[model samples]
Target: MTMDGKVALVTGGSRGLGMRMVTAFAALGADVIIASRKLENCEKLAQFVGEEYGRKALPVACNVSDWEQCDALVAAAYAEFGRVDVLVNNAGLSPLYPSLDQVGEGLWDKVIGINLKGPFRLSSLIGTRMAAGDGGSIINISSMAAIRPAPEHLPYAAAKAGLNALTEGLAQAFGPTVRVNGIQCGAFLTDISEAWTPEVVEVLTRDVALGRCGEPDEVVGAAVYFATEASSFATGATLRLDGGVR
Candidate 1:
């Protein structure tokens, strides 16, 4: 119960790493706000946390790419939980394109909107509130794609790079009160792995010191550390969780 009485608001929290984070917060004695595009999925996880841990869980359907939805999601979380002690921006998208030249403007906007814009708006709104009262934490779920970006992942890599920058910017903006950080994750065998071919997986995993993609559960410890007193002296930092990709 390290986080007893705390409230954690996690975006893209319906599944994958996001769902893992949602479950972790509940186990730490924090009530959770699970948000994503699908309300039913959020609800299912919400009910499970409530039953398993006796923690209050709120389900919110939010398309982070939309400014209006991001605003509504924060309002909804505050309405239900009174305050958000931890905010995790975990939702993201990286659409596939045959070539860089084939990447349409529509797809580009979608990737940037979800990967960067939504977190910007959400953090500005909630982080300000957290800074002014009681203080809280902000965690941005970034990607290693920002560093060793591949051709097909240009837009996604660029967006995550912006996220890394935003992480530092928000840390400074909310400093002396709120702490902000990012988790620069590498390949994880989440639901999205179903889309990876054997060759693709091999190429992605070969250079890692661990020689394998990460598990969703492995991300929980860093997340909890950032959310609680364990990282009280930390902020404006992006921790790599890519299994020592070299």
Candidate 2:
């Protein structure tokens, strides 16, 4: 799991699980590129990483949902660190809707663009460079809703299902040099969880074998595993980090 002398680029790295991953990689001796829509947040985290871990952190403002911004992000990372040894596609969103029929096209496109399209573009660009170079790892952060779709998150679920497929397909496309994998997360008490209704939270907590939602830091182990040689034998696999959701 040692990342000394490596560079990691993480989307949504300003906070939540992404933030934890950025800091973890830094602690392991990897310089980081933190990309998010909020430049201020990214800058703050970057400063913290430099002071706390003595690792270089580059703050880039990017909305992964846009293809142009994704392109710029890749370019910026490479320009800063020369190469990205690890890429974590952790940016995603699932907006609440009152009814299925009320789910408009804008919402659908936004969900798909962020959860599926963004990862695809980033993986294709970065994975190609990684393959051409010394090799790298790409980790897509998916959701349990991908397999167990509900009325509340149908669009989001569909997007994540596509992300799962993307992970497998990309692993094959960039294999032998670059590896791609996914983490199908269950309910986690991140900023997003604050939006979950009480009933929704209760049901998810009851369903999980652990009888509770996961903390943001709990994702560090899986994130580290996929990012380093710890998961060298794993690729095209989606590890369930749902606390044994049944």
Candidate 3:
């Protein structure tokens, strides 16, 4: 799908899946706004996209967990591009804790804030603008844990489940124009996977139909689909990019 002349703003657009998406969109001819907590990482990706794809890239330092920062990101994006044709809520974190009982309030809040709250705030802000403007697409990068909750990642699962619900509700709220969808992803060998033990990796791979974790770029097709007219009639849908996780 060609996104020529369009603008895309992606949160967490520095490393992993977000990084891949930034480049993918740029390659398809969309100017990109890369937002992340680290200014240097975002700048590096922005420079790469500009130099490699010959597309404009704006780097904004933001921690999606904060409401004020989310507002600022939107302001910055609109100020730079005037409009955002695609918005990807890709920033998230699922930190490990010793046990459920040991999940302190700080940890719980941090996980929920980054994974759920941020998406809600960003979507609300940008979706409204998209609905009022020439229409656009909003994609949530969720996890399969949202549906198949595990004790080890209950908080993350809960947050992602909320994100799924938000996807559906927002589709209606911003309908008749702006489209909203979600990508429920399975295990991917991202930077996060570097922490997985050999046994953990084996267990993750053995049960999936694909027989292995996905590469970072594997999710690009789905992301591109939702971001463009390829999924023109698919708002409120949550596509499983999980390689048939079971």
Candidate 4:
């Protein structure tokens, strides 16, 4: 799918699935803006993308959870590329893990703020710009945990589930303009896996029909599909890329 004149903004694009999505977008001929909380990491990825693919890759520091930063990110993308044709809400956090009785307020808020509120805020900021332009596509990176809880990751699942609802709501609210959809990813190899042990990985993979964990590039396929004209007829839909785990 060619995105010749498209401009894509991928949050958390410093590494992992986010970075892979950025690469996919760039390969498809979209000028990409990679944003994350770390400026150095963003710059590194942007430089690599430019050198390897000959695509225009701009790096900007942004914490998606912050409203001002989200606005600044969209503004920077507009300034660099003249318009944003695709927005990938890929930044998220899953730090809070506790039983209902043991969950703390701080943990709850942090999880909700990053995983749910961040996408909402970013979509709001970018959706407005897309409306003013000729409209664009919004792809939210959700998790299979949103549909099936992992017990320990209660807060994360809840936030992601709520994010799915928000995606549908926004799709309807901005229909015939900005198309909104979510990708429910399964186990993927990323820095997040650093927290899991070999044993945990085995257990997780056993449940998947593929009997293996996925690579970040696998998720990129979905992002590319959702962002391009291929999915022009799709909206308010959650595409699952979980290797048959769900």
Candidate 5:
């Protein structure tokens, strides 16, 4: 139990890569807090985590895009666990893959609000609590789109690039007490895959050196490592878990 007695809050923990991160933190002996927009979904996930890991799991409904909601989320987690040791800024959205010419302003704002602003708000709210405690780690889940421009996903790519910049900036600003890093994930088999067709998956797989898409668990390993003491010296870094796509 490398993270014994620690507390972790994972946004968007109801499903996908976020869910896997919640499980990983629980397995590492952290009392996990799973938050999302739906209360029922978080409650169900909390029950499962409690049963599987035999540790306290708290679930709270939160829309990370809202600053007030993020504040409430941090307050609830602190109430349950007394402190936040790890914060996984995983809540994000990639609505539709529209080319820059086809993208409307409304859709662009929505995507950026959820993908970039959400993490920024939650990190600020939770990072304060962490600073008060014994310091903590912040893992921002970014994407390869931040490095490689996805023309079809213009808004998403731009937002993720901003998130990458935020990760680095926060690491430097919150140093000596807190560590901030990011994971630039490639292709992972998650609900987001529904956006891709079979042809797209086939073409993308051919480009990956691993010859297949990454699993949710594979990405969770990096999240767990960053959350634990193993990455104590690591900060202002972006770990690429993209099946050697670069």
Candidate 6:
């Protein structure tokens, strides 16, 4: 897939799957906007993409949990690139706790706000412009937890399920010009993988068709398919990327 002169904006592009996608987009010849909570990390990725891929990269500090920040992130992307052809809502938060009883209002709120509300605002804002202008694509990053929730990750799973719903709704809302889709991701060795113990890993892969966690770069192909003309006829679809785990 050749993006040639396109502009791509990715949330949570500072590290893990987000960072890998950012790199893949740049390599495909698209100018990239990498947004995350930390300016330092974003800037580091932006510089590396520019130097290595020779594609323009902008690092913007954004905390998607805040509505104001989401607005600012949209404004900044449009201001710098004039337009964004691809928008990836990949930022997420799933903090670990010892027990479900320990889950608090704050934790639930933060997880839901960032995972669900953030994408809704960003896609509504960007997809509107995309439909009006030259058109674009929006990809929401979901998780398997949305379909099969474990007791430990109930909040995160609920939020991801909301994200899947948002993807379908936005696809209808932004039809013809802007396409909306989702990637229901499974376990991958991202930043959150540090918490996975041997026992946890064994259990996760036991019934999985692929029998292992995914690599960060493995997600890039699905993202590219959604971003480019390849998936022009496909909208409101959610593709699972979780190593075929149910």
Q: Against the true structure, candidate 1 has what lDDT?
A: 0.95
The lDDT values for all models are 0.95, 0.95, 0.96, 0.88, 0.87, 0.93
- In model 6, pairs of residues that clash are none
TM-score of each: 0.99, 0.98, 0.99, 0.95, 0.95, 0.98
Ten-residue region with minimum lDDT total, candidate 2: 187-196
RMSD of 2: 0.9
Candidate 5 lDDT by residue in tens digits, 103-180: 888888888888899888878877776776679999999998888876777788899999999999888777788999
User: Considering lDDT, which of the candidate structures 3 and 6 is the better prediction for this target?
Assistant: 3
Off by over 4 Å in 5: none
* lDDT of each residue in 59-146, candidate 4, tens digit only: 9999877778877887788788888889998988887454678888888887888888889988887887788779999998999999
- Provide the lDDT at 156 for model 4: 90
Task: Give the TM-score comparing model 2 with the true structure, all chains together.
Answer: 0.98
- Stretches of candidate 4 off by over 4 Å are 96-99
Clashes of each: 0, 0, 0, 0, 0, 0
Which candidate would rank higher by lDDT, 2 or 5?
A: 2
Candidate with better lDDT, 1 vs 5? 1
Q: Give the TM-score of candidate 3.
A: 0.99
The residue-by-residue lDDT of candidate 6 on 1-246, one tens digit each, is 789999999999999999999999899899999999999999999999989999999899998989999999999998998999999999999898889989989998999999998998999899999999999999999999999999989999999999999999999999989999999998898878897799999988887898999988899999999989999899999999999896
True-vs-predicted CA distance for residue 1, candidate 6, Å: 1.3
Task: Supply candidate 2's per-residue lDDT for 165.
Answer: 99
